[model samples]
Target: MNRLNEQFEKYLLDNLPKSKSFHPHFEKALQQMLVAGGKRFRPLLVLSVTDALQPLLLRNALPVAYAIELLHTYSLIHDDLPVFDNADLRRGMPTLHKTYDEVTAILVGDALNTHAFFLLADAPLPADTKVEIVKELAREGGIEGMIIGQAIDCWFEKKKLALDELKFLHIHKTAKLIAASLKIGAIICNEKEIAKKLYDFGIDLGLLFQIQDDLIDALQDDTKAGKTTSNDENKNSFVNLLGIDGAMKSADELVEKLETGLEAFDTKLKNNLKKILNNYLYRHKNL
Candidate 1:
């Protein structure tokens, strides 16, 4: 991993003060989920943008960055639950529901979801800034974003969809949060125009990302995936709509678009972010 990646990983694992001592159950689940290793890409994005804007971000960025992680982890927990994707494993370990129980998993996810905003609310940033971040997170992670996307995905199972429809579903379901992550981080830095650009970048980047994920799911072994593979067999995907060759072609085109989009930004920041994206693409067969 590169220096920025390593630092971001370390930041993700860094400890924080426990909020009082009233709730052990929720805290345990949150801590355990937080410790489980993953890319920590979203938080890295937030932190990196903050770094670009300011020399030091650990104090103001940590809580909000952590809020993003908690929300993400909560999404995974629910996504892995029996009712949704019925996934048993995540990040190469038993999912929250599988590790604990269905009810515990549900509560854990809920706790993370609610607590994420609480963290945001408690962030040391200015009140207006915190409000913007909170609103952005809620909008992206809530009904207008992931939830709706998930609904469309579930609704479209075993159903064929037009390319535009599929794109819309992916945009809402996955891309929005990514876009929001970039935008919110920029907002934290009080860079509105940059935030907007980051959000737009996120949209295209997210499309590329979800397409890669679909591709990986199509090709990878279940054990390697740590979750279901070919499970979206019934859902709309680039690999499902376009064949493997076509999917790869589309993904390459999207990557090109994403790169082109970054041309307007600071060369160094764009390069570093692209490096991270490249690492992801190279590590997975789908991209």
Candidate 2:
């Protein structure tokens, strides 16, 4: 995973767009956000599934993986905007809107969003495959998915959300894109059934990830989290709604379910996934 992450980071740096006639500051702002470190988990999901199916095709899937990262980054930028979460920090640095002007941050997010589609469209894959990938991403990232989830999150601020409601909010906002990442890789390899199974697995994984994040925000400080803590105080989160212990229980159950889901895959793929889950669980043991 570390090696793959390094390779993906290099690919991103090499392929990211540069300003032509635009002001240097515009390019700088975009570059700054891109270089700011992140987990790059979504793109890794793309690579992982592709690696399992066809290692040779992993090269061809690079653009799609990068596209997911770009879209994820764009969402982060916007999510930290004053109009949204009003966050001041991200990845241990000032949020984009704080480092640059709000307008610059907004434009940078827009640019990244469009560039993600451009990368997907320009990838060296079949047109039909590209279209399918694009459709999945658009659906997951657009109003029907993440956007609506954001809307609900913001609109219901200060109001407690029920457990089911919280699940609905995150399944679309967080899980959908994650599920799409796996499905996109599966689609690229012509593994439709695997795509479906992976999508289901991704839903559980995404919810577990979100629950862990909520615990981090509630328990850890800013430095440990590498971002602002307590930002979800008034937002809907497993920690806020379910309490830390309950959220941990939920995460444990999800992990068990995710592990069980891996039974559908071959031994090699299942082992790879178990490694991922084990690493994650080990890292968050303190939580």
The clash count for each model shown is: 0, 0
Pairs in steric clash, model 2: none
Local accuracy of candidate 1 as per-residue lDDT tens digits, 210-237? 8888888888877877666777777788
Candidate with maximal TM-score? 2
Worst 10 residues of 1 by lDDT: 278-287
Candidate no. 1 TM-score: 0.91
- Give a tens-digit lDDT track for model 2, residues 1-287: 46567779999999876776658688888777778878888898888788888778989999999999999999999999999888888988999888878999999999999999999999999999999999999998998789998899889989998889999999888988988888898988988888989988888888888898888989899888888888888899998887888988888888778777888888756765665566664344685
What are the runs in model 1 whose C-alpha is more than 4 Å off? 2-11, 14-27, 281-287
Off by over 4 Å in 2: none
